[model samples]
Target: MSEFIEWGALGQVVVAGLIIGAGIPALFALGLRLLAGTTTQPQRAASGTRRAADGGVPAGPVAIARPTPARLVGAIACMGVVVGAIAFGLVFLVSGGH
Candidate 1:
């Protein structure tokens, strides 16, 4: 009886893993489609600034610069801290910790 129950549990886990593995690509494709549908095409930057007939300076900066490495790292660190806090809360709840 115990052996039969273990086999059933193992079969359930195998079936669930197979389903999840099969679903991952479908889910990824669906997410891509949704993202593509919702996103607006970005406007192209002007190749060269148009100058006044009198030779005036260009109005704005040429290109937007990328964030510095420190800023990017700080932002990622903040996100990790938030996710870690949420995970700790979930673990505490599941473990019945006060």
Candidate 2:
């Protein structure tokens, strides 16, 4: 046996740390991205009037963005994973996994 290090254990720790530390943030960001996708299309003015010769900004009601069902599902799924990971960590800490 090596005096200062066990390569197998060290490797496991490194891999686990990478996954838990980096992966959680990545997942959370993914969730936010999924949830925040714009689903609104540019809308024309409700009135039939067209823009003037200057061609300035059209006078119209603001377009409102709503989340698509798929995006909502994806975001919920990603957030669920993040929340589950947090819950698992808390449980692990309470159970002396440290």
Candidate 3:
């Protein structure tokens, strides 16, 4: 049985499993805590102009900033490349490759 089992592969698998299984939940919980305030009720307008009964804003159009899909994709691709490069370097170092 020992002859059939590759310890390096087994260690990699275990490390990968721990990183994904444990890291994901921790990151998710952290993100949830960071965004917890967004779900709260909106604060009442201070001394600003009162809204009409129709609830229409008298101000000009509100500017809304949104992340574009292309930018998001680019960011993700960049991160993937960075992670891949780091992993490759780590693997090379672990395997004693100069």
Cα error of candidate 1 at position 58, Å: 12
How displaced is residue 17 in candidate 2, in Å? 1.0
Off by over 4 Å in 1: 1-64
lDDT of each: 0.56, 0.84, 0.59
The TM-score ranking, best first, is 2, 3, 1
TM-score of 1: 0.35
The residue pairs in collision within model 3 are: none
Which model is ahead, 1 or 2, in terms of TM-score?
A: 2
Clashes of 1: 0
Point out the worst 10-residue segment of candidate 3 by lDDT.
34-43
Over 1-98, each residue of candidate 1 has an lDDT whose tens digit, in order, gives 68547888789889967755655445545443333322333344365554576255444544444555665555555555555656886898999996
* Candidate 3, lDDT over the whole model: 0.59
Measured against the true structure, the TM-scores of the candidates, in listed sequence, are 0.35, 0.70, 0.36
Question: How far does residue 63 in candidate 3 sit from its true spot (Å)?
Answer: 8.7
RMSD of each: 12.7, 4.5, 10.6
